[model samples]
Target: MGGVLADGDRVKAVVVKSWMASTGGLEVHYQDGLEKGSSLKANAIQQGLEEDVHVSGAQDMETVVHRPAKRSKVQLGSAPPLTDSARLLARRKHCRFWENSGDEMELELLAAVGRNLQPGTDSILLGTDSHTCNAGAFGQFATGIGNTDAGFVLGTGKALLKVPTIIRFVLDGEMPPYLLDLILQIIGEISVSGATYKSMEFVGSTVESLTMEERMTLCNMVIEAGGKNGVVPADETTFKYLEGKTSIDYEPVYSDAQARFFSDYRFDVSKLEPVVAKPHSPDNRALARECKDVKIDRVYIGSCTGGKTEDFLAAAKVFLASGKKVKVPTFLVPATQKVWMDVYSLPVPGSGGKTCSQIFEEAGYDTPASPSCGACLGGPRDTYARMNEPMACVSTTNRNFPGRMGHKEGQIYLASPYTAVASALTGYVTDPRDFLM
Candidate 1:
């Protein structure tokens, strides 16, 4: 056989496909008459391949004889047009242990770590839910595995994966103002486990127009629906967004044309309205109009989920439109310092090019350190004030489980940044529709 296998204390192989690293460092391909369950050693395999090499435990290898491609027909236009296969390869090849002390450093760390891993290493596991897929941006079949799964992967180079069904989200028309909030509302309706063990694929023409940040935001929320993973097919748009990064040879992966979807959901972005979630659960969703009279003690507008640039832009609009200071204490922490720098530089809504940093500072809102989830995840900054304080808070973070935002007694409302900013001005949950118009 042309395939080279080397044997030592452990087994290793030189495989043509780099992504196969997850399959225990051995490449299984059709070349010559090789029987299943064949053994190869670390030194037997040929060296000097264009791609990187990997090693795995001897027990990790498996063979499925003569199985046809899992799916038959291929689906076109189902993936985002902007995927960089080469970059994904670079990220999987390199592995390192580096601490990200600050927000800017964290992003750099993530990028650097991504660049170091070789494609096809045992699937990477992450503690986070949404951003875990960012590694997928590098093409290593990465996913946000829970704590237990992560533990298992760390110990053994194998994970028991059940191929998940796919949920196709076909987006049409332009996204309305405050689109993230709207997306959250749709997600809320599905509850936390609606898509459990399923692949959430975002498709349609409108997806091409969204920025990488926007696509990431959507993909990141797959966990909210209890999905195993979310993906956007790589396209030209993906390439443009990833320009100037290290390059690797890549090919976009898509659903088979004859691929059967477990279900389909359709949305016309142009018709979406601002949405919010009631206290204690991401699924407790309602239009902001429904919660108009709820008073609040704190209004928080930042988190991994809500701390992006578009989020701040939406919040700024509402703040400027209110033409007033926030009635209650408002906490705004950027997801990372990079996001803070971006939002801080933008001029306040009505001010003649005055930046938000000046406007917020002058208005008395507290700007905490970067890379802090702060009050969003029961962090130290804002604990529940009083048992019956009747205080309401609007935030963009995911999950509203009791005691999630500091105090069990405090009432927390989940909304997009726009709604949160509007409510902060009035000290109550107010509908964003009135301000958007």
Candidate 2:
């Protein structure tokens, strides 16, 4: 159960027991002992499994696992490790579609897929952009590809290769209250370009402790630090989180016996406090207390990054604390239609089947709209039109570029869904920690 599942390999079998809907998709329950099923089915069953069963899926379906291949600890330094293989790999898989299209419209058209077909035509490109990694949830080896590498992939199907040195940030301890906000702040400090061309593997006691919603929040940010991909080795936590939710088999990815990493960073959850990122960048890391006075015009708490069930739950927590109407225009756009349905309609633990929209409306904010890329992609809903008026927005989207939300003059701040809710209530950049108690 702890080892990696190879492609096309069957490890065990489990019987279907029940069904549950997740942000990812429909999941099915299985008895604790069966070993073979579709990876998608496995994901669903993994979430529903109350008892253990044998499970089987493809090697590609396995979630990469991380174990310390070497015992020596390495200190953090200014420069990242140099690796030829990772660089080559990045070059080989850059975006070819954007290259083929000369204009934005063409690129958008290429992104669209037929309703019944798989969106991934072949290999996919990754971006620090939140939407870039959405393809992976659909079962593609998709990740964010940088401008340099994107150019190469666009020009040629293959980019250069330099196998990344892995750095596993394991999760063992319980996440502090509103920990999702803390993750965004940490990633903010790492910057959208920090892990450029690196493989950032998440492994630790704390990682093993998080729910799938929480882990996805972490993995979703791999591109934020410029890393090629952020992965968690499949474990009990992962399997349980994903069980009964995905048909995809839950396989684990293990590092090679000789796997090498340039450095490792560890965080003690017990010592962590709530955090927030200032406007206009996901990298503007700061203590939430330091930026409480900053006023804002909009607070958006949804996107692929922060629009999941866990995200909605976090926002609801903040709304409960504020105990009033939001002062500003706060928009909650679920990442996908499925997510919207679950949070707004589906019955689940904690939710008691109350939709997120019902919660928000009860809390005095506008009910959320249907799913879309929305602010993350500068779409129609809640876009910035005026510039230089000092409008502050706390969004769950990844990038906060000059015109990312709309007008070049509008300012955008990146944070987790919880932070957005806090700001929405206060009409300013408010820290989530103050409400935790």
Candidate 3:
């Protein structure tokens, strides 16, 4: 009823009637009407409501209604049936809903669909989740939109978007082991709102040498700095990551040699050190060592931004190297089931066949929790690992704003996986160089 009638009267009438029959009356609120009407139409076709009800769009589309008999087993396959033990463990760790979404996190969902879609080409990706910009690592135009736009995309497979001005970041030095520090430096220099409504384009030798995971981490944080999107040009590294993930034919695009930018910044990261964002803001940058005098109540390592398999491996490398148990209660939540399995199955390269889970255990840490967003979203009060009282925490999550991880009065220090693990080992905001070097 809300989308364009793409065909003759028969099809249009069926869609409109099915939507009206599914729900009584019309949705009149401007934004709600746009979304609800489009969604109802989609549901009509997807659920075969057109076959169940026979009515015409011209026949009082606002008045007719139909309600189907309730199914005996509603949402039977919506989520996996976890065992009582599994459910208990998930609750204790505050992880849930992997079965409902198929994938545990939005980043994983992007991988499943846009892994092979080339950027700079005629391809576009729109997600309801803000971090959809993460796919910019593969050189694609990806960004987040509201439910109204999402519903429109659902009804029709196209969307309208304005082109954003670009800001180029030229990174040309040997990168330090702590990648998060680089992003923190940029955010600190530009402040959170500096890139508002602009695309941040990363290039130069350092970006070219980064792994896909590292590139994704950088692009994922663009939204935190008010960026519309972030991009890293597609190269052999991007193509290699796409191999075996998708078979779709896609053409790659690149910037012109004389492409103009709203602004340009250059950084040589060879001398960088681990950094963190203090509580109440992500751009409040401070060197990890500068905050070593600050004690923490816990350490958390999870979320789409910092809970990838590679992130875990970086933490495990610190744990194995230190050969020390965590001084604080360290929590682990992998971002997806695939990453959870990898922590248990994939061996650390120099750990004599030890997996991350084993290394974590040896370092007196709990087994990696089930994969999900967990406490990073500050979900329900009963969420596992959620901070229930005022306390300090060092997390690998990208955000450190007040109440971001649960309690409004709690303090959060955002750091990279390496810095998070190192701080966990010492119960303070310790620099990763203390261990990594």
TM-score: which candidate is best? Answer: 3
Better of 2 and 3 by lDDT: 3
- lDDT leaderboard ranking: 3, 1, 2
**Tens-digit per-residue lDDT, 45-140, candidate 3:** 122232222233444333322112221111111132343234334444454312223344664346533453565778777778888888898888
Point out the worst 10-residue segment of candidate 2 by lDDT. Answer: 100-109
- Candidate 2: tens digits of C-alpha lDDT, residues 1-437: 45443333323333333332212222222233322442323333124334332344322222221122211111112222232223323435541212211111111112222111122234434443433543332223346556787666556757765767666564457777766754565576567777776767767777766666665567666776777666655555544444444453333446676877766767777677566655566777776667788788877766667777668777876766666778887777776555676677754346556656777888676577666556666655445322235467778767777777776667787777766777787887777766666
Better of 1 and 3 by TM-score: 3
- For all candidates in order, the CA lDDT equals 0.59, 0.55, 0.74
Q: What is the lDDT of residue 61 in candidate 3?
A: 31
lDDT of 3 at 265: 96
* Model 1: lDDT of residue 433: 63
lDDT for each residue of candidate 1 in 1-437, tens digit (9 for 90 to 100): 23323211123233444443432232233223332234322211122133323333233333222223321111111121122222222234443333233333223124322343223343344533445654443333446666687556556656777878888888888876655664575577677888987877778877767766666566666777787767766667666655665354455566789988998888887877677878767777887777787877778877666766667767777766666777888877776666777767866556778667666666567764465556666755444322234455777777677777766766778787778877887788877767767
Model 3, stretches more than 4 Å misplaced?
1-104, 107-109, 112-116, 178-180
